[model samples]
Target: MAVSSSLSSIHISPRTPKTPRAERLEDGEEDVELELLGEDERYRATQDLDGTDGQAMEAATSKQPISAKDKRSMVLLCVLYLIQGVPLGLALGSVPFLLKEHLSYSQLATFALSSYPYSLKLLWSPIVDSVFFKSVGRRKSWIVPMQFIVGTLMLYISLNVQKLLDDPGNNVGELTFIFTLLVSLSATQDIAVDGWALTLLSQDCLSYASTCQTIGLNTGFFASFTVFLAFNSEAFAAKWGVPHLTLSAYLRFWSIVCYAVTLWLLFFKKEDKEPATEADMSIKGVYKTIWTICKLKHVQLLIVMHLFAKVGFAANDAATSLKMVEKGFKREDLAIAVLIDFPFQIIGGWLAARWSRGDRPLRPWIYAFWPRLGFGLVATLIVYWFPKPPISMGFFAFLVFHTVLSSFASTVQFVGISAFHTRVSDPLIGGTYMTLLNTFTNMGGTWPKWFILKGVDLFSVATCKVSDAGVDIAVKAAECVSDHGKALCKDINGTCVTETDGYYVVSALCMVFGVIFLVAYIIPTARKLQALPTSAWRVKMS
Candidate 1:
């Protein structure tokens, strides 16, 4: 059967008669009519060869009916993705602020190097596909061991966090090593889980995979980022009987959770293994499959789009948290902003799925692009006007508006793009191909941060002066102007003093790329691409 993404494209029927333009104006529904291509015509568009008529019909016969087993499969996949999210949440959301008290902005970015392992995971995906223990299961063999190591590492960190906190300078190297190791293990486990999903879910149920990922990931992020931080706060800790909540305690809690989940997976879950083909059983075959995917014309275009799609707002996202902190936004304030953003994100995903269902699977991308660009500019302004005085009710109103608008637009765009990738990736190499798309997306968001950090280092300045009594205090460059005009304070009073301009420039770059891709590539090509049936991506393994 044709392996289509659950969030598949709209099948426009060619038989619909053309109508006047007036039909589109009724109730905001689109009225344009076009010839709907048959599934065979769509499938042929993605094929490189002729004469597979009998095989194509045979392929269509593989569709299976849903039963209780299918429902259990979906639930297991959701749990697997959720488990993948916890450590990821801890790494990206919590680690920055947790280390903020000691690390400078530059140091924080430097240490955040650990998080980039996820972006590079495609490099080792072939190995993940090629090797496994026969006793447990191919995917489970990797998943269980990786999770065990990850849990052990978290517990190890919990035990020694006090020594590290006491002497951050001496212990930072160790902390970075441990954190990087933790992130690496979590990323590897992701490979196993993703591969398992491909094997477990039926084609009809595959589209919901991205939805499951978004929900589970966001939930885990809220828990690790917001809830854990709250638990570690002085107010909560004291109220809960601990006067001082050490990092060890916070980590230990998660360590126990990880261990419990590991046990659950080992005993409670059963993997019904499928026999591996010759290519799947060998490393050479894995690379050959990867090579074949890269050579596909549509897949090649997708790689480029995935790389540049998010470039417009990358720096803004990376700098927002630190910029907020510099503007006196507390940890709780950042957490609250994310809390407001989360549900809107999930709603956006649901909306995208609904909108993509019938005649225009790519419609969300077109509709969401303009808002994303507008809000990208709006977010830049919010960052530009950092540390505004009095922190008024109106200020928070703007914050809420910005967060909600941006989150909605971004989530919609993400859902469309993720579904598009899934729709086009060959199922034989599903895990590896999907990882490649995600790796590119992650890299698009990452490379810009390096430049943003470099600009911050070059342009922004921070200084502390020590008094005779041995008290040291931070001094804003604007404050030093009266005492040190021209000689030291030139261009230091406002706008030019902070890295806000860097954000503006980056946001503009993203908008330029967005327009280029939308107008030049995405809009013109979307209709033709969507016309191709989901079967266009399927191939017999070599």
Candidate 2:
């Protein structure tokens, strides 16, 4: 909701009275004297107080919008969100596979290079916020140019992957560098898109707006990843004949298409009315305001609960696909399995929409939470028991089950957090608050990647040794060399460096983090729901 009315809280004290007689008598003022303005004129459609009747004016402006035009903006922006997600997720998942398999680069290195740019984008958001393109207005200004750049890079990457791989003399490093730049550009587009989403939505309908936004975003993401998988598979058998790198090339092609569509959209989007944003929409202010919100006792528990919810997700994302791989699924097969879960997200979104129709208390929303969490645990068990099973009809069955459970958990999480954030954030800094919270969640997801990777690597090496002689740094270096290659094992500043075994390390990290989160965040969140007043959870709305 881009709507802001706190600016209307203007005060005129005894010491600072209303406009002086002379000032009030300016030529323009004579057109409609303050006294003649009347009750209705004073407050009509205003977001701020001015001239006179500030509080009285605000009361009138507080009415919810009834326009059909305004309502449709949510649906339109949701479509954009859902569409953009495909390119984003395709890039997120497929690019790494392409690099590791075709180019012989490491997945960790590729992910950090590709994905790191997105997380670091907070650095540039202020520029996006404060500055709008003079010709196209702020949102369009940033979005249009960046969209072209992302598209161009995707096309470029697709065409050049082979040339770079064919010759050791060629510079894959430059290709990676170019890819990083496009990521930065794409992330800026994300920032602008979010701002656009906020502006189009009204203050009165934030809950609905956010629900649609999440659904659209997840829908786009799921679809894009599926498309990526399908395209990757089909491309693997295509004329390019670049086996391992096929998906990456196809993803690049997809990015080009994404950029092209976004560019086309640039022409269609209307210019936004100039709105005061720094005083209203800045992310820096969120840092200060989040502290203030944290002090509320009732809300504080929800915030902690919010923090706890991520433990499962954080652990799950860090290792799930790799686990699936270890369980003998091919990358293409895994991609197909993931594609099967898309419908569950829609189901979850529909349920949330239903829940929104009633004025129910937040607790009965709790019923869905346990089943979602239980589904995750069940899926995990099934996978573990059938570890390394062939991809059969039954395997697809488990895949659907796991995906539905995962989607349910994701739905519950989205609806809960959106509801929580909407309550806590002041309308004055709502967009800023949401972005900052997203940043925290990003940290939650990212911080554990390497730690998990390293710990799992160490455990795997030690388990393999299992000797009283003790595995020294040299032994670890040898193991590293064995796992990766001799080039990866080297000495730095007279200290030994080794390439950690990725398979064992990834498994160990997931298991450990999964157990911790299962006990800590998931259990506590469950407990909170159980403790909720009985009357709160029984709303029969969809």
Candidate 3:
């Protein structure tokens, strides 16, 4: 069977001839009209027709049943994306809480360096897109090895993580280096999987690809974060009458899981072969395509939008949970909040995916932006009002409620944007194209984090004090800011005292920036971009 035929069996009914324009407008209820096209023709068709145009040309494409191949593809995508999320969840979600106990905001900020690899993966995405062992499989060649490496790294980290965290000197630099490598490997795997997803599913159902991504990634994140924290927390274990799980043991288990998953994929899963007339796979060609994509006005606008869009939420996202922890909210309790939010996030993603369909895929994203930002402000208040220990059930319930709302908005924005990306991305260079957009999106959130964390320390007013009999002598502010300085203060029997908390200051400023960004740039630019034809997002290859 021809590739298109094997992918989906279209059933177009006989109808009276009509003008192309009339056919497009009047045939709204007809079965999807899928045409057989050679690789070159398909590429040209993609460039000429935006996602909306493509859907219009297909009429009511939703009537078509998903092929078995597409079903298999969806399963493959979910598994691959789930595996990809494990390390990220551990790095961004769980590790920060663990570090917050012993590390200063500055030290935690330094640890944020590990996440940069994910944001910077676009730098090498072209290589991943272009170079692969075609015989082994375009994507699998990269996915298999990268995942194997990831599993190995996890095993290594499992062995050393506890000792590294326990060291009085605190191995922030070393941990950053190690996790950076892990995240980089995962990012590379992500590029491969993203590319594969485009080819795996038929064009009509492309949007669900992002849905699978959201569900799978969030599930992995929940497992590594909420479940891990709950299991590892002594308080949680004691309260629940369950065995306490060690971080090392948890990491080792996932490492083994990673290895098992990797082996399954390598042996059991088979990648589809690319057609001979596919786009150029050369490094130069892929880079050239990236350059062309960058030159597009729409892509440039989206990049700028992605870079500035997350500034408003940076403080809430990066610091709120840690701040709550600083203020005596237990990690286990925080985990409970996340657990409540988890199901809602998945539900939000599903709803967003449904809402993100049609021409204006960014509609839901645009709608959710302000609400998400508003919740960020609310988060600061929640943290500020966080009660001292022996907290009431009502207060915990409120926290969970706030978390669900905040996460729901965030999830909607994420899924909506991802759906828009899936619609606009050219599948010819799916890896590079998707990676480029995703990189900017990730960078929008990642780049501001380090500064946000550092700002907390910069704005904080604290003093190192030593007791001389009944009197206390205050040391310089500079002497208590650095980890080394704090250690030195501790050596002389001095304790750090906080006069002012910077979380409020930074969060208030971030909310202001968010409002400014939303009004001046995000809303207007997003509206304009969404109104543009999908052709604007496609690179016109010569």
- On a 0 to 100 scale, what is the lDDT of residue 525 in model 1? 67
lDDT of 3 by residue, 1-542 (tens): 00000000111121111111112211222222212234544344335344555556445565667788777777777788888788888888888777766677888888889888888887888898878887778888898999888988988888988889896245888988998999899989988888777777777677778878887787777778778988889989999999999878887887788888888877877776766534456888888878877866667889999998888988988888776776678888888888878878878878887787665678898888788788888888887787888789999898899888888888888888887777767666778888888888888988999999889888878788999998999975652544444666788899977677777888989889989988898888887776654444555443
Q: How well does candidate 3 score on lDDT at residue 109?
A: 82
lDDT string for model 2 (1-542, tens) is: 00000000111110101110112222222332122122543233112334346434323433545467556776665665554454456445554444433332133443445455555565565566556666676667776777677667667766776676464224556655765676577567766666554445554344455566566676666555554655556544464464543644565756666766676667766665553432323344434344544443433445455444444434345445544554566666666666666666666655664453222313324445455445546555654565555567876776767776766666655664454334323333323434444444444445555454444344443222222345443344423312232234332212334334454445444555555765656555644533322112111111
Winning candidate number (lDDT): 3
Reference-based TM-score of each model? 0.77, 0.65, 0.87
Model 1 spans > 4 angstroms off: 1-70, 166-172, 235-246, 275-280, 357-360, 387-390, 461-501, 525-529
**TM-score: the better of candidates 1 and 3:** 3
Better by TM-score, candidate 3 or 2:
3
Candidates sorted by TM-score, best first: 3, 1, 2
lDDT of each: 0.60, 0.48, 0.75
Candidate numbers, best lDDT first, in rank order? 3, 1, 2
Error of 2 at 37 (Å): 22
Cα displacement (angstroms), candidate 2, residue 31, comes to 39
In model 1, state the lDDT of residue 131.
84
